[model samples]
Structures are given as C-alpha cells and as structure tokens.
Target: MALILVVEDDRLVRRLVREVLRAAGHNVRTAVDGRRGLRLLASATFDLLLTDVLMPGCDGLEVIQQAHRLRPGMPIIAMSGGGQWLKPDKCLNLSNRLGADRTLIKPVSPQRLLDEIRDLLGA
Candidate 1:
C-alpha cells in the first residue's frame, strides 16, 4: 500500500520487518545501517521511513533529520532496542523530539507496526 524503507542494523529484525510489510502489500526496501539507509533514501523516494535509533556508522536521528530535510512531509517511525548503556524509551523520546512522526520500542508486534503504518498513511 506504500513504499516503506526499513533501516535497521540487526539482520533478523530488518528481514522480519521487510517480510511483514511486503506480506501486507507494501513495497518494502531495507538497509542494514543508517548510512546505507541514507544512501538509499537519497537515491529514491519512500512514503515512510521505519528506522532503528542506534547504529554504528550513523544513527536514526541523523537519518530522520536528513530525511525530513530531503522530504519534508515524509512520515517517520523510529524504533529502538537500547543496550545496557541506553534505554529504548529514552531513545524513542529523543527521536520524537527530533521529528519522528511515531516511535516504537523493539520487539514491536507485526500487527502493531502495520496499524501504525495504516494510521500514518491515512489508509
């Protein structure tokens, strides 16, 4: 129903998200990290961006800022499964302030993700 870019460092998470969205009829593309995500984003157009907040090279926050600058009205959902040093909720909070249209903690249910996407897409 929409072109979505899923940006996450964890391979399993990225694959799961892509598969779920695809199964639901979305055209889903994915990147392994935020830098790759930005590269893909720069070269193409996406109706929504679903990204993880923590990554090695670049982070979701940077991606969000650049994505917003590149496509001002693009809807963004930032997700995080924070490590020992950080908290998922705190990361999500920061992402919200940085202009994420929505946020989710990791281990998000597929149905919930789809529901949020439907709401964001006004479907």
Candidate 2:
C-alpha cells in the first residue's frame, strides 16, 4: 500500500476519493485547499498527490510547482471539473504543462482514478 495526499475543495469529492483509495488499500490524507495540501506535503512523506485544479487559497498549479520543488520525483495527478472561466480540458492541459504527471476530469470513475494512481505509483 502507498501513502496518498488528496487535495480537493469539494467535500463530497474529497471524501469519495479518500474512500476509494482506502478501499484499494492505500493510506489517504486530505486537505481542503492547496495551501494546506502543500503544508502536508512538506511535513510528511507521500507516494502520490491527487489535487483539484481550481481551488481557493492556493490553486493546483501553484501546488504542482511547489510539490515538484519539494519532491521532484513524486507523482502528481491533477483533477478538475472546469470552473466558470476554464474548461476541464484546458485546465487539465495547463496542469500537465505545469508539472502534473497525469490529469483527470472531475466525476472520474473510482476505478479509473485508482488505475491512474496505480500506474503513477507503479502499484
């Protein structure tokens, strides 16, 4: 099992992701925003990061950059449902460009999310 950090603003999505990962035998920690996510990333060790693109406090792009700075080899999976101004594809593309190893659209299937994590972590 691997340790995972989930950074999402939506409560339901965050809980669902945590449950899914735990069901897959992974240890999961969650943060409501990227700011907290970064703090957690700095303070502890994690095998992967699952973050939402658009969030309050700090955005996922910033998180991605800082995460890379903090742990260059750790994998990052960026997820977004699209905000009022940006489409999901655009957000994901930007995330990829910034440093996310993988990008997923919101409402992602539990199986798909798990699969991506597995691929990233080589689990």
lDDT of all the models against the reference?
0.94, 0.95
Q: What does candidate 1's lDDT look like per residue over 83-122, in tens digits?
A: 7899999999999999999999999999999999999999
TM-score of each: 0.98, 0.98
* lDDT (Cα, tens digit) per residue for candidate 2, span 10-40: 9999999999999999999999999999999
Best candidate, TM-score-wise? 2
Clashing pairs in 1: none
Q: Listing every candidate in turn, what is its Cα RMSD in Å to the true structure after a full C-alpha superposition?
A: 0.6, 0.6
Clashes of 2: 0
* Model 2 residue pairs with clashes: none
**lDDT for 53 (candidate 1):** 95
